[model samples]
Target: MGTVEDYLGGLRPEQAHALRRVVELARGLAPDAEEGTSYGMPALLVGGRPLIGVTAAARHLSLFPFSPAVVAAVAPDLEGFSLSKGTIRFTPEAPLPDAVVEQVVRLRRAELGA
Candidate 1:
């Protein structure tokens, strides 16, 4: 998708709704971020750099904070979620918690020096 909206638009209703929550959370943290793409996934860009990304997969949604270190730092708070070095995967049924998302965004902002 060329934009975050386009990506979110193509998902199932529930998935889109779930990801919109994440998108809003990220936007709140980085009020000046622009809609963009990173690693071919829809993202929020700050200073033209990816701060966070959201995606809908076949069976899961993902939040990409663009930093493996940020994922590690928030590891303790992310029990039960599927985590990779740079992504956190969650289902719409088990949506990512707002606090966790806040932590991710803040950490990414710091990492970006934004």
Candidate 2:
């Protein structure tokens, strides 16, 4: 998709809804955030730094926090989940916790001192 809205529009209702939740959570936590694409996935930026991203994959949809520390802090609750340095892999069937996402955004913002 050329844009984040186009990407969201292309998914099934449930998947789109999950992606929308991530977007809403990111925006709510960082009102001045900008929306764009990073590495072909939709991303939200806080103070010009990448804060979060949502991407569609063959097996699952992913919402990446873009912070290794944030992912590490929440690793306990993320057992059995696949993750990389800045990305967490989850299916659209499992919606992301808004609270967790907000915490991540808050932590990242604090790290950025913005």
Candidate 3:
């Protein structure tokens, strides 16, 4: 994708809306991050490194901090949400909490040394 907007545009309204909120929140935390992609997924790039990525899957929305450690550190707060080694999965109807997202973004930034 040329930019995150292109990725978000292809999503369902609620999914796109949720991902937008994610990108907005991440932007507030890392002003240096730019709209970009990592491994073909829409992402926020910090120092040219993918800090965080938000996208829609077939059945749920996903957030990738691109670090398994970040996902592990935040797993306790996620509770009912699905978690992989480096991803958090949720639905737009039950979007991730802003506070949790804030932590994820900060941790990813720290991990990236951004």
Candidate 4:
């Protein structure tokens, strides 16, 4: 039953700071996206569909771009970062770049027809 703010508040200072930036970037890209929880993670929903989700892990912060196609599109640019089928992992020390974040959001928005 926790909110996004509550989730962010529970993270360590560094983790929280990095996640806050991601959240800010998401909101900037999709102003109308609703803030809520998805699969126990803080997520943004556009047109009632999950747009993006972020998580604070022990070693790094995770960005769930919510699209495999988006991940594949950004894969070349993610050479130095750790990535999975759906999650892009980065450290608090070296947070995700703004451009990368924007690209992810833009792709997801397009996929959602937003």
lDDT string, candidate 1, 3-111, tens digits: 9988888889999999999999989989999999989889999999999999888989999998999999998988999999999999999999999999999999999
Q: Residues 45-108, candidate 4: write the lDDT tens digits.
A: 9988999999988888999988889998998988889999999999999889999999999999
- Show how many residue pairs clash in every candidate, following the order shown: 0, 0, 0, 0
- Any residue pairs clashing in model 4, and if so which? none
After superposing candidate 1 on the true structure, give the runs of residues whose Cα lies further than 4 Å from its correct spot.
none
Candidates' TM-scores? Answer: 0.97, 0.86, 0.96, 0.95
Model 3: residue 76 alpha-carbon error in angstroms: 0.5
What is the model-wide C-alpha lDDT for candidate 3?
Answer: 0.92
Question: Comparing candidate 1 with candidate 2, which one achieves the higher TM-score?
Answer: 1
Per-residue C-alpha lDDT of model 3 across residues 25-50, encoded as one tens digit per residue: 99999999898899889899998999
Candidate 2 lDDT by residue in tens digits, 1-114:
465677889988878888888788778878998878666677877666777788877788887777789888877777777878888777777766777777777877777776
Q: All candidates' lDDT scores?
A: 0.93, 0.78, 0.92, 0.90
Best by lDDT: 1
